[model samples]
Target: MPAKIPATVVTGFLGAGKTTLIRHMLQNAQGKKIALIINEFGDLGVDGDILKGCGIETCTEDDIVELSNGCICCTVADDFIPTMETLLAREDKPDHIVIETSGLALPQPLVRAFNWPGISTQVTVDGVVTVVDGRAAHDGQFAHNVAAVDAQRAQDENLDHETPLSELFEDQVACADMIVVNKTDLLSADEATTLTGQLKSDARDGVQVVKAAMGALPVDVLLGQGIGAETDMAARHEHHHHYHHDDEDDHDHHHHDHDHDDFESFVVGRGEIEDADAFTAQVAKVINDHGILRLKGFIAVAGKPMRLTLQAVGPRIDTYFDQPFGDTPRATKLVVIGEAGLDHAAISAALQA
Candidate 1:
């Protein structure tokens, strides 16, 4: 049998900088080919497009798969394994494969997928890297109270009895070989240190915690982590009552439930934003009103020729100009991912406000 190819799974909550970290690694990669499987939370494939825009020369069209119907970790056999097999069969096979699960995904199920039959002989579980939002952690986003709300948001009304976010946080931390505390730039030095200390306390002893800015980290540190699924599976806290072994078999149920009318992604591309503060205020209001989890895209602000890249996860928003628009039309193109029936007209009017 051939040596199993090493693959890394990147898991985190919404807007935790998983995609940014992967892009940085790809940009600074030392000639190693990588296959990126992006599990978008919604029905669209925007995340996959963002990954492709990262300019990784090695990753072709087939190398990327967007599992939008449901979380990839939960739908392993149906969503993950077949994608792995497809990548393996390609003539320009990647030396490494990275799977970025959705913000609401549980990493253990995805890690467990590596041990399944079909791809087990072909691929090895290298490690599970959990990207955490430093800003969010500092604000107690993982606290038990908010965790409860997040849990309710992730599932259908029927699953109101499932495990809470506090448990889910432990599950993610318990299963990780390393935790990348991303978006450190958003936190003060003291805040970052305190957050890191709290994270270390939650993580297993000696589970390395690295502070990252804009998801930038040494590629060597992210890859070849050698955290095999079979070796340290015991260290992970197993959730028995909520998710049963048979539950994996009924993945379609999760998908059907996942398609619930909770979240939707829409773009604002008509006009330029004249006031960043006013636009951000409107975004905050929208989030407060309809539970918008993420907002990201470039805003073409009036009087400023450069495009301002705007991103918001939870209540926190970050903005920076990546590059000049040059010849592209100065239009504000922002994608709002939030609950169903979000007042699109209100959102659009606010953007134009």
Candidate 2:
């Protein structure tokens, strides 16, 4: 029998820089073949698209797999198990499998899925890497805006336990083999130290909490923990009971009442834009006005062949040219994520105007 492949599960909240961390890991994969199973929470596949356009040589088209139906944790039996089975059956198996889960995902269920019959023999849960947004932690937010997150939680009728946002954050941290506190550059020396200490205490004993900026940690530190997390189920129980399934067969019922119902996302389409900076500024205004949690998509800038990318967390919006539009349509489309009840027509008009 062949050795089981080591799979690393990268779990974090929205805007926590998990994609950036994974891109860095792929670039520094040291010539090893790595596969990515990117799980997206919204209507658009923004995270997978970003990684695909990243231009990292080690990461090829065949190496990237995306699951956009819903959160990987909720769809473990339906989506995750089959994906893993297909990957394991391939002739050219990846040396390492890295899963970048949706921001709202519960790592406990996804990690525990490795114990499934067929999958158990083929892959081992190498480690569960939970990334934290240092600046967000300093700002006292699980999602982007503190007040907005509070508003969303208050509106959730099905919210029986603690606030889902905070519990989700704790669940991610609670299930980690190692924690990467990213975006520390945005924090002051004293602020970074304070945040790190807080996270260290939250994490399990012996779990290393490292600070990073721009997700600049080495591949050695991120992967190869060899902890086999699937076997450590007792220690890594989920913080929120609504997420993790007691059995793989029971996941279908949970999916019907999934936690994602607390939030909503929609894609907004617009015509071509002339100015990238101006467009982003307008986006910033819209985000502030609408209290959007996340907004990321490609924009077709007028008179430019390259596609412009936009990602916003709170009021901070980053824009850049990621790839050429080529034959692809030169139109602007963005997926807007926020707590439920976003005014779609109003926001579209605001961006368009």
Candidate 3:
């Protein structure tokens, strides 16, 4: 029997540089043939499109596949397994497979998919890498403030339930064979050390934590770990395990529907904007008012032929001209993801106004 092909699962929060790291890997793949499976949370293929635009010879458009049907973990049977089988059956099979999971995905469920009969014998999980935003971690974005949490607990013993973000972050850390603390450049030495310590404590013993700036890491370090993570599922903890069934027979029908009732995402379309500054300010206002976690998409400025790209994590918005509209319909389209119950009508009106 031939050896199983090695595959790496990259999981992280939104805007944690998963795509950047993948781009870096593709650029440095040397002579190895690598296949990429990109999973996105929303209807738009923003991350996948960004990766396809990387212009790397080793990982071209054909090498990259996007699964925007839903979260990869939830659609493992319907989408993930079929995709892996297709990749494995290729006459010119790839030397390795790299899966960039959606920001909202849990690594354990996806890892469990490798245990399926057809896939189990063909591909081995090289490693599970979890990337953490250094700045967000330091700023208590994912419930890092121990003192505050402790005080709240003391005030109300009933406040024992963890926030969705905290649980998600912890689950990713717990399942990681390697934890990459990315965006370290945004943090001071002391801040980085503190965040790293917190992550190390959350990770299982012997799991290595590496610091990186701008998702820069050697290809060798990220791959070839040979972790065989599927067998280690007993040791890796997950927050949603109770909601899952142990029987493989039930997995196909089990959706493992993620509890996303608190989150919402919607697309906002507009005609070409007359004032770029005004549109940006309106976006900032909406983000601030609604506590948006992520906002990104292309925009059509009245006079510019090139498309304007807008990305925001929290209140920080960055804009730049990525490329020409190129005959594609030029319009302002932004996908806003935030807490549920966001007034879409008000938001669209504000942006259009």
Best by lDDT: 2
**Which candidate do you rate higher for TM-score, 2 or 3?**
2
Total backbone collisions, model 3: 0
The lowest-lDDT stretch of 10 consecutive residues in candidate 1 is 245-254
Residue pairs with backbone overlap in model 1: none
Residue-wise C-alpha lDDT for candidate 1, range 1-353, written one tens digit per residue: 66678898887665676777777677767888888887654444556776676556777666777766554655677766787778888887789998887434467777777777777787888878888878777786753134433542455332224565556666778878778887676889899889878887888764667777667666666786555765567788755423311001001111111122333678877577668888778877776665555677888888987889887654567788889999998887888765356788877676555
Candidate 1 vs candidate 3: which has greater lDDT?
Answer: 3
Report residue 314 deviation for candidate 3 (angstroms): 35
Model 2 lDDT at residue 110: 83
Predicted model with the maximum TM-score = 2
Please list the residue runs of candidate 1 whose C-alpha ends up more than 4 Å from where it truly belongs after superposition. 143-162, 239-353
Off by over 4 Å in 3: 143-163, 241-353
What's the distance in Å from true for residue 155, model 2?
Answer: 14
Off by over 4 Å in 2: 145-162, 244-353
Clashing pairs in 3: none
Candidate 1: residue 176 Cα off by (Å): 0.8
